[model samples]
Target: MRLYNRDWTRREIEERVGRIDQIGGIQRVRGAEGVEDGVELVRIRTGAGLSFDVIPSRGLDIGMSEFGGVPVGWLAPGGVAHPAYYDAQGEEWLRTAAGGLLMTCGLMNVGNPSEDGGISYGLHGRVHHLPARHVGVEGSWDGDEYEMAVKGTVDETSIFGDHLRLTREIRSRLGENVIRIRDKVENVGYTRAAHMLLYHFNFGFPLMDEHTKIDFPEATLSPREADMQVDGYDSWQSPEKGYDERVYYHRNIRSEDRASVRIRNDRFPAPSGAALPISVELSWDAATLPNLIQWKMPGQGTHVLGLEPANCVVEGRAAERERGTLVFLEPGESRHYELELKVNPGVTAP
Candidate 1:
């Protein structure tokens, strides 16, 4: 495995494709590859459980990245669950999770680009697609495969926009085939305003196909997106019927011992066709991330899944008010949300 550092400019670039200067928040520290294993899963501590290795290989594509011999898909990049377009618009972008993991909290770009979302600010946000400022080198390890881990943070007024203080410790391990997220959010703001925090996990399609299903904790879901708008790719719908804007509200689904859900593509070659499950285990506070969004984009090409745990359901403040999902932090208050993604790989059920 290879080790290095990720600064602030690189921290938020985790959303979508890399735009180091356009990103904010956390950044990456370690990167490596695996010889025996095709996909050298690294141990990255991202609250998003998703990130990109952003390999600037010696002789590879400036956009492509991989430390050793690991599968590009694993370290490639993941996407959020929603289409940037909501109201006949395009995809939107918020502040990303950083560490070159590639993230944007909101839609891709529907009406206008994030730089001009018509909201005075930019489309995604000031730190929507920015990059992180290299802080320091983290660590590297080697075994059957390679594992990489790093650390970065978001200063006040980045993504949170609340003059919030963000600290992230990202770790990626090789061979283990799984990454863990141990994170914390501190509200260093003066006024107590409503906040929305969600992880926009992007998984490659084919890897996400007709066989995929999204599971949740069964809490009273906020509500469906009124604008059953369209996005990229097609979908491998479930056996159920009346599949228009399908959503699930759960309570115990987030329990560590809960059933797993996934977004698998029958055309893809992962575990089986629509067989691999993407499950969520609750930690921190299950009630906060009560609502889970399941989206399917099949034929659009580059299929992916977004398992979002939002503080607010759909309308942010409106959903939070209805679902009572809003979490408040005093002038010096802080809250932490922990989520872990265990790749069943070939295991249909976990």
Candidate 2:
């Protein structure tokens, strides 16, 4: 493992620290406050300055993240609310939607609030607030390399309804500044079920400033709202008061199996005294997540960017069915999705 400034053997690393945790490891903690009380979080530190919190009480989704003492994830004003506070009504999900590093949306629905057959669907979905079961965490050494992982299962099921089970695993290495999210959604019930999934990855503050650059995959882009299109649609702006959010959809991305987007900020200086930028890149299996959604909102106190990968668009479930883009899984069938996030402290700019 390469920690600090050079290579470290297992013996050398273990000898330096009385306990492995003295350098970096995983810890299970509970939120002890109003609304956030009883929330179980698995915090992992990669020793390489990458640390993040995974909420098992909230569908195994990731919360806050920081690298080199700098926060890269967006934390909403609502804090980390417990799953008990989730409301599935129209747009009510936003109330407890503690914006974090990654929020998993949907098992049955995604996007706009709509009703079908007298059943109402919420803003994003009910997955983010669903508690995970069979949670597991492990940090082991593979030869000289140290690998850490957290795994759990979250289900969005009800009586006579969809019985979708989502098994998620988040992995990272001791000296690596990268995290991978692996998920498999299965229809464990006896009936075929509709499935919609979207990974809402958010970035804010130091990572998303005025001069930040966003490099999206080459694709055909279209605005969600036709009239909201502007000249510099891909460029960001300074946070302005009362600014409206803009949504854009990217499709037909030109990539060989995997599609990615990079967000970079050059304001931070590196050890080499070069302004090479501190960047984060998200890449996923394009075959499963063929569409990308960009949520650009540079509003005062709400300055955050959400880059989402999904099988379905932001159109409601009903619209997805009407458009024939909704995915369905047969009984006992499963679908797998993989996504990786890499943080590069630009030793050499790309």
The per-prediction tally of clashing pairs is 100, 0
Residue-wise lDDT of candidate 1 within 26-117, one digit each (tens)?
23323333221122122333222233442211000012212122211312223211112222222323221121222323221111232221
The 10 consecutive residues of candidate 1 with the worst lDDT sum are 56-65
Off by over 4 Å in 1: 1-130, 140-147, 156-161, 213-288, 318-324
Number of the top lDDT candidate: 2
Give per-residue lDDT, candidate 2, residue 247.
Answer: 91
lDDT of 2 at 174: 91
lDDT against the true structure, each candidate: 0.36, 0.89
